[model samples]
Target: MAANILLTRIDNRLVHGQVGVTWTKSLGANLILVANDDAAGDELQQKLMSTTADSSGAGIRFFTLEKTIKIISRAADRQHIFIVVKTPADARTLVEGGVPIKEINVGNMHFAQGKTEVTKKVYADAKDKDDLLALANSGVKIYIQDYPGDKQYPITDDLLSKVE
Candidate 1:
């Protein structure tokens, strides 16, 4: 069986109870890659996330952004890999660094103190909108999805609306 990645998601609350109990199973995730520099550096957080990465021996990995970009660009697996990032900045970094991805799934971006819009499953602020737009123009599909199984709204949809 060729291992593949199911979804690359951005969620600050990485490996929370929902992830451990629900998302993993619902998505049939066999690997969870926590690609956040801070999270990977913190020993305690790493241990905690590891515990939640699952008891099923699904390979759990944590990589700094640079390393992750290299790894994802080269990876070819069929077993589902579920990546969790803490923020959109990380997403931007990966794309800007030229990681080969066509789309990104946004999941549960918590309300910060900026401009607001709860579009579908994501809470997007003004800056988030700007970033998403940039990625969209670059041909990346930025989407709103709280879980892997959730229905998605492609950023392209919004782009089309504005043009019309």
Candidate 2:
């Protein structure tokens, strides 16, 4: 059986205050899954994120792309999972690998070289745009909303064009 995935968010800062506290509380999620390849392989990061999750009264797990694809389907129905990935590409990989993601919340893709600003909180580069477009083509509802209380802006072709 598939896990009850409450939310799939793209935030470079995964499992931080906003995610571990606000999102979990709002969604009533019992588990926060940081499905990022980098975080999954780092022990110190895992420890720190675990501390944050504990403080929020939610369990947390870090998993690589492959591991997430393999294990997420096994999560019990009672596990209300809030998944966070670092980039749109990572989100696409999860969906392609059969993670059952139907929608994606585009959160923080902080400014970096080669990336264009899509929103004050979101920036995207060539590869990011391609991945996002691919996800949209595959029938995923992509939108931008930093916090739980913020307004959601749907990712339309016009918005993607602005990033170009």
Candidate 3:
């Protein structure tokens, strides 16, 4: 059917306070789909996501990247979905898997051991930068927006150069 996927975001802290309360309401999303292999397999992580709860009263589901890609076409027909993955690589995977992702928001990707800080809240390693570049090349509008009212910074070659 018609594509109902609204916003696909890459946030390391998936379904947290900002996402649970702010983005769901802003996007008018009825479903929050968390596509992450680690969180999908861990009951504790799932439970934590639930405990945070979508203050906007949206439904939340967690699935592995493969399962999410497989079911996305069918799921889109059912609701306005907001898909969140932990990394740019996962977002790239979804796009490559034929999910009609029009745009992707890079949100909070906290400091990691090997990742270099690209933006205020975003950090990227070599692979992350590569995946982001791939998505941009594929014609997806890539933006760096941490919160609802934050100014969106478009992903460009100049921005990509800052990844180092």
Candidate 4:
């Protein structure tokens, strides 16, 4: 059985060209679950996104993690799956909700208002940092990276070292 799930990443852009052309190939998970609630509802947006994310052969399911968690948990015919979350809260929610997360990759949180100190290519706001700490406490490994093959920046250390 191949990996049931391979990569879990947080990228706001979701399934972009770079992601499709790179991450999916690297992680060996062509199937992606985009865990966003609002994005799941807007039919029009979903249609547009689906068009962009579709790799013709690769399978991409854009749905809320809450909706797909059960299905994923039950599936046995192993598939490489990459879960994409929009925010740190969403990632934390999944972990707190009982999803078995081995590792989560923070690709690009980008710069935003109300965020904390910028370090390297990653930025963590209060909520984001709290989630990092929570996951760390729970023993989930986190790697802050910009791209699939990029060097990882451990968010745990970043937060601890910079926290006042």
Candidate 5:
């Protein structure tokens, strides 16, 4: 049984103030799942993010990519889950692993050495572009939105081409 997935977001910062409070309340999600291998293994990150979610009155859990695939696939219908992953590649893995992600919010990719600016809040490197293109090809509706009230920019081929 698939869980009642409220939102699937790609934010490099994972669970932060905006996501833990604003998005949680807006979506009415009861649980926040941080699906990142690094956060899963780092107790400090887990603790910090857990604190953020707790403040928003949402249950929080950290899981590796594989574990996330397994758990989310079998999640109970009553579980209103909000999944947060760090990268487009991770989101692609979840979708390919049968997590039933239909649409994805590209929240924040952040600027990095090899990345090109896609939007004010989104930056993508070659690998990120490839992974995101793969997801789009697979029928995932990908868009960029920083907050709940922000404008959504759909990731089109024109947008991707402009990155280079």
Candidate 6:
């Protein structure tokens, strides 16, 4: 069976309960790929995410952005894959690196210094806005929805214009 990309999402908190259970179940994904540079090399993070994925009864894989870009094609053809990235930049990188992503969901991004609040659950700084703009320009649809049953808010140029 050729695995297809079920969904791609950007969430700082990668493999938590909502994602492991709700998202996986709703999407009918058998595999979850958490692609983030920091988490991939961190043994502690890997184990934690793996445990979460296990609890959800989904096969999980962890890889840095580069490694994911390199292996995404092969992985996608193997099982239904749900990809989770840590940031907008990471999603842009994946698309640029040939991941064939057409849409992305913004789940959660914590508030940080210098970031303007884009939504109750998302914050964006300059680089993040830039990355998101690039992704939009490249024909990738971006939306914010923390869960499968939530209403989706599409990311628009008008929205970005008001972020400052």
After superposition on all C-alphas, the RMSD of every candidate to the true structure, in Å, is: 3.9, 1.0, 1.4, 2.5, 1.0, 1.6
Residue 36 CA displacement from its true place in model 6, Å:
0.7
Report, for every candidate in turn, its global Cα lDDT versus the true structure.
Answer: 0.71, 0.90, 0.86, 0.72, 0.90, 0.87
Per-prediction backbone clash count: 7, 0, 0, 0, 0, 0
Better of 1 and 5 by lDDT: 5
| lDDT against true structure, model 5 | 0.90
Sequence-dependent TM-score of model 5: 0.96
TM-score of each: 0.78, 0.96, 0.94, 0.85, 0.96, 0.94
Ten residues in sequence with the least summed lDDT for candidate 5: 155-164
Residues 1-164, model 2: lDDT tens digits: 66799989999988888888988899899999999999999999898888889988999989999999998889998899999999998999999999988879998999999899989999998899999888888998888998888899888778889666
What lDDT tens digits, residue by residue, belong to model 5 across residues 32-143? 9899999999999998898899888999989999998887767878788899999999999999998888889999999999899999889998889888888888998888
To one decimal, what is the Cα RMSD in angstroms of model 4 from the true structure? Answer: 2.5
Tell me which residue pairs clash in candidate 1: 2-78, 3-77, 3-78, 3-79, 4-77, 4-78, 4-79
Model 5 stretches with alpha carbons more than 4 Å out:
none
Rank all candidate structures by their TM-score, best first, as comma-separated numbers: 2, 5, 6, 3, 4, 1
Kindly report which residue stretches of model 4 are placed more than 4 angstroms away from their true locations once superposed: 1-3, 160-164
Clashing pairs in 3: none
- TM-score-better candidate, 1 vs 4: 4
Residue pairs in collision within model 5: none
TM-score of the candidate numbered 4? 0.85
- lDDT per residue (tens digit) for residues 86-144 in model 6: 99999999999988788799999899998888888999888888888888889888888
